[model samples]
Target: MKEKNQWSSKFGFIMASAGAAVGLGAIWKFPYITGMSGGGAFFILFIIFTLLIGLPLLISEYIIGRGAGAEAISAYKKLAPKTLWVWIGRFGVLGCFLLLSFYSVVGGWVVIYTGLSVSGNLLHASADYADIFDKVTGSAGITILGLLLFSLINVIVIALGVRNGIEKANKYMMPLLFLFFIILVIRSVTLSGAMEGLKFFLAPDFSKITRESLLYALGQSFFALAVGFSCLVTYSSYLKKDVSLPFSAGWVVSMNIFVSLLSGLAIFPVVFAYGYQPTEGPGLLFMVLPAAFSQIPLGGVFLSLFLLLFLFATLTSSFSLYEIIVAAFTANRFRSRKIVAWITGLIVFAAAIPAALSSSLLRDFKIFRKSVFDATDYLVSNLMLPIGCLLIAVFIIHKMDKALVREEFFLGGTAKASLFSLWRFLMTWIVPLTIVIVFLSMLGILK
Candidate 1:
């Protein structure tokens, strides 16, 4: 077996894991989905789920990782009772590949937008801003080019290994991401009528809350926390035993929420400022935000910086996703980790092209006749991620030894016996049951 690499420090592990959680899901997906769904009400529900449902699942993933000391797939064989749970672990690893495939494409968009921002292309754009969005998004070439560039960046980072590659990038890029985020929020929220957007985002609308809304809230929490993806498992496998799981979990959630809310403050104001409907779908960031940026003073500078920072967020995330596969292949001795890493990167690039060209190249592959993006997203986010999380919770809470999990996670000694019971109860019942229901609801199996 290839030698396992450990994080040089606790901070490195936390930052890397948090970087995975704080991906396009936070900066891009959260605001658009919140608006599209309803607004503050949906967001508040999302927050509730994050704290209650998301945190416990995260703890479970961490416990499995630290206890088993392996990648996601092999983690099952180490921790669970029956051989069956290993299948869940395998799906989690597969989900990583699927997630990375399209995520690389989106990451490329951020990189391209950053370059465009630096070139002042955004500043002088004409009044028909929506048309500009159409021009960029409708073109297949731009999308493919963006995916290729992002795939290249991920390959380079993963090849560099943890401390030298992941740690070094997070130490600099994550902080800069926050700085640019704050600056953009300040600028976006100050625009005339921006308060209208802020109200839309933060002021709760109770009417919007429903069973479906609750399920969506749960899904958002999972997506935002990156909880169900086994990324935490892969990442914490590198963590030293002395690190506190509860403490690290709290920091990851807190930092992710801070950044996500700040992203809302940044983007919602711009959406309202531009007179765009809050409910515009996936293209909200690329299409709506650019138009909003065009209207700001020094808009090009602000947007250029923001997009670059956004690229950092996505790059760090892509790095983690790639690591899941790299660890699996390398650990299994299929090839040197480095060779597998390169091959994985190339495969991701090739897979992403169809997604990039879904509206163009692979638009008509009829199975229910969905586009490539639709198919890939359904396979990963809606299916594998939730199932993987459910399995991890089951194995940790039921199949594994309780005393060991408690010892590893509640290392600070301040946690009482009752808290362990509560954690176990939540893991056994609340977390898994919720994920199951949400998974069913998402598939239209429940009314």
Candidate 2:
């Protein structure tokens, strides 16, 4: 029998898992959402929920993955054989497939912009940035080409397998990502009138705390950590039993939070210094940002670095999505990793075509009165995500043996029993209840 691959070191596992956790949410969504919400108040609530719900779920996945000593689907099967429970992992794989398809399209956008940044087109002072963005998204040829290019990168890296591929990529890229962010933040905070943006981001306004904001914070906690996809399960399966699941989860959570802070600092000050609206949402990253960067000294170079930084973040996240599906197929060793990876890449490229054309050739194509890209994002983000998280929480506390979970969680650490009890209390009650409410609210069923 072939031996299952393990991470070469605990640091490698932490970096890979954290890479899986940090994605576009950290780069694009986190900063914008914080701006729209109550800034520091929303951030604090997000941290609370992340620690309360997201952290426990992460630890649970780690325990499950390492405990079973198998891939995503096989772990469930090994733990609960011949039952419907295996569907949990299957659903995760399916969700990841759909996610990767569209995510790569976004990644392709970054790729095109990165090239433009390097070429100085994206920073042209007289250029209509909004019109340029529209043209980019509205061009079917450009979008699909980007999709193919981005997916190809993942295919090649993933084909190399974990230790040489995902682990190594994250270990190097994450530090570079932070360095880029720090340089941008320094430049941003130095801009005249940047203090207002800093105040808006770091100063908590208790008055901005509302029901909707609370829900946004909760959902961001899940989205920001990439918790719902079960990609962490595949990453954690590579972990050694001696590595502390709790410690790894803590670092992942902390790194994600720090990146979120850096993202806010990097963008909000620039937006405010330029008198641009922070609530520009998705356009803030693609449109307003480039224009803002254009006004700075040697802006083209800085913008190129930022775009490449974003591309790195996007690819890191995409690797996990690819791994979840690829791991399932290669777990039993019937298929070669390289072949399966290329096939997976091809499938994602094909699936992403419609989304790539969503704003262009397929602009008229709508599901549920939304464009294909918007519809897919809604399906995966609102529905599949919550259901996956709910199922994980339920599986750990209800379906799985209580004693084994207890034992697995405490395997490598001398943490307090009170901590385990707290994890149990949250997973058993608070986590599911919050997810259900947040899910319903997102679907407009509760509100």
Candidate 3:
């Protein structure tokens, strides 16, 4: 048997894990959702649920992975040999596959826009942001090209192996992600009318709170940290025994929240300052952002920087999604990791073609009254993710032994009985129940 790989340093582990957690969920989706879901109130609700739900599940995944010292699927077989708990890992890998399909479609849009920004074509004083966005999404050639290129990037990185590949890529990219974020925030907040955007994003308005806002806020927090899927579990599997799970989890969560807040500060100020609405989905990032940036001095240059920032965040997240799927098959493999990775990339690129054409050639096709891209997003976000999370919570609380959980959790430090109890309480009761309610609401059974 071959020795399992370990992270070169604790910082590399933190960055890779944080890179996994911070992607479209934080920068792209969170800002638009915040705009639609009561702004500051929704932001507050999201933070509350992140602590309650996201953080615990993150810790549980680490405990499961490091405790068992195996990849995602085998981790289950190692711990709960005779039972069907292994299905959870299978489900998570499947979820990631479906996620990356549509996720790559959007990633392609970022690629197209980033290149356009470089040519000074996408953002200019006379450019129409809405038309540019529409053309990009509606053009099959452009969308497919973007998706293919993005998929190739993911494939090459995964082929290079863990330490020399995922870790090294994130170690530089994650810091650049933050640096670009800070620069954008500084530029955005300095614009006239920026204070109004700040107020909308930071000042909680109880009056604007709605049932939908609460639901989205909770769901956003749960999904935003990249916990429902088994990607983090695979990443943590590479960690050394001496690394502190709690401390590492803290850094990932903190990075997630901080990046989310920074995205809001970066985008909302620009949206408000430019007198534009904070629209939802690709429109916000592609349309509204371009329009806002176009109004700034040398906006083309700043827009390129922001797009590059967006590309880095998207790639970092895609790396984890690709890693989990490759790890699933390549564990104990005779075939090369490179071969498995290229095969995985081809599968994703093929699956994502319809999603990339959702706004164009496939515009007439609908699943559950939604476009392919929208339907895929809804399925993963609303159905697959919540179910995956619920199973994880149940497995941790019901199947795993308490002593083992405690030992894995506090392995490098003294056990805090209070923290253990709190985690147990949430996993045993709050986490599962909350997921059930949210799932019910998504199905229109609760409201």
Judging by lDDT against the true structure, name the best candidate: 3
Candidate 3 error regions (>4 Å): 1-3, 295-298, 441-447
Using lDDT as the yardstick, the better of models 1 and 3 is 3
Off by over 4 Å in 1: 1-5, 125-129, 210-212, 295-297, 363-370, 440-447
Alpha-carbon deviation at 149 in model 2, angstroms: 0.2
Query: Least accurate stretch of 10 residues (summed lDDT) in model 2?
Result: 1-10
Q: For residues 205-260, what per-residue lDDT tens digits would candidate 2 score against the true structure?
A: 98988766776777678777777767887777777777888888999999998999
lDDT of 1 by residue, 281-350 (tens): 6667877667667766777877787787788888778777888888877776767766787899999898
Cα lDDT for residue 43, candidate 2: 82
Cα lDDT of model 3 by residue, 1-447, tens digit: 232656888888888888778888898889988998778988898898899888999999999888778888988888899899999999989999999989998888889899999997787677777778888888889999999999998898788765776678788888888987787788788888999999999998979887667667776776688888878788788778778888888889999999999989988988887667865555686766776677667878878987887787788888888988998898788768899999999999999999999999999999989999988887887668878889999998889777788888888666587988888899889999988887677567887
How much does candidate 1 score in TM-score?
0.93
RMSD of each: 2.3, 2.3, 2.0
